[model samples]
Target chain A: EDQVTQSPEALRLQEGESSSLNCSYTVSGLRGLFWYRQDPGKGPEFLFTLYSAGEEKEKERLKATLTKKESFLHITAPKPEDSATYLCAVQAGAGANSKLTFGKGITLSVRP
Target chain B: EAGVTQFPSHSVIEKGQTVTLRCDPISGHDNLYWYRRVMGKEIKFLLHFVKESKQDESGMPNNRFLAERTGGTYSTLKVQPAELEDSGVYFCASSRSSNQPQHFGDGTRLSIL
Candidate 1:
């Protein structure tokens, strides 16, 4: 069975603090890994997509890195406005119909 | 271009009742997807449509659920005889291509009494 697990169900950091959230998975094949940020009462906003191990993508203060079995979303000097639930999802097949399997997500709180 | 949009941001109905949720995908997007998340659970895929055709629906729970994308545009999901376990957040997403990242809507919160 394909499954995705996000570690540290919740994380709190000071305004300038930096940390990383982990997402581990077990899938038949890794087509792509997606990262999203969801604010309260809103849908998830697309962040990054990593297709291979050792790949990294960055946007503003957030950076996403991928590995064979896991992915990490690293936040640098996060601000309060950056607080949101971070979700990690994986596509299991290389085909067009590949379904997405998502993790429970990690809730982040950045205190200013 | 607008993002995916879902209607009836929240729906409350009694068990055994029928509820319909709608989703309008981004303009020119050919791939639309439906997902649901129950309390304390990760979001689960329900179905996928590509240009009014059902590409995959293996994640659909049962026969009571039906999804349609009319005219290769907006889509609708109808749940008949809703059960208590059916209460959850239903999200709609769309993408231009299979390999592209999906954009999501605000989602509809369904409650079955």
Candidate 2:
């Protein structure tokens, strides 16, 4: 079965605080792993997509690294504006139309 | 580019009533998807449409839900005889292709009485 689990269901950080969120997944054939940030009352916003283990991508204060069994979203020097629910999803096939299997998500609260 | 758009950001209806939700994907985006997040549950895939064709609807819960994309343009999801279980946030997303990152709209919050 394909499953995505995220740890520390909620996290709070002070300004300039650095931390990392974990997303572990189990799937038959991993095609892609995605990271998204969602604000209250709005839909999710795309962050990064990792295709293979050892691959990494960075944007502003955020960095995403992937391994065979899990992925980490590193938040360096976060600000209150960065508060949101971060979601992790996995696509389990090579087919172009594979549906995403999403985790429950980790809510992040960054205090200024 | 204009992001995906959904109508009636919120809706409240009685049981057994029919409610229709609409989604307008970014222009020229060929892949559109429907997802639902029920209260206290993970967001689940409902179906996918490539242009005007239904590519994969295996995730659709039952026959009461019907989705259509006429003229390979905007799409609509109709829930007939809506049940209490159908109450949730319905999200619409689109991308240039299925393999691309999907952009989402502010979901429609549906409440059933």
Number of the predicted model whose DockQ against the real structure is largest: 1
The alpha-carbon lDDT assigned to residue A21 of candidate 2 equals 100
Assess each model's interface with DockQ, reporting 2 decimals per model.
0.85, 0.78
Tens digit of lDDT per residue, candidate 2, span A1-112?
Answer: 7899999999999999999999999999998999999999999999999999999999999999999999999999999999999999998865665688899999999988
Return the clash pairs for model 1, or none: none
Instruction: Please give the fraction of native interface contacts (Cα pairs under 8 Å between A and B) kept by each candidate.
Output: 0.84, 0.68
How accurate locally is residue B104 in candidate 2, as Cα lDDT from 0 to 100? 90
lDDT of 1 by residue, A39-82 (tens): 98789899999999999999999999999999999999999999
Model 2 reproduced share of reference interface contacts = 0.68
Candidate 2 iRMSD, 1 decimal:
1.1
Scored against the true structure, residue B39 in model 1 reaches a CA lDDT of 97
- Report every candidate's CA lDDT: 0.94, 0.94
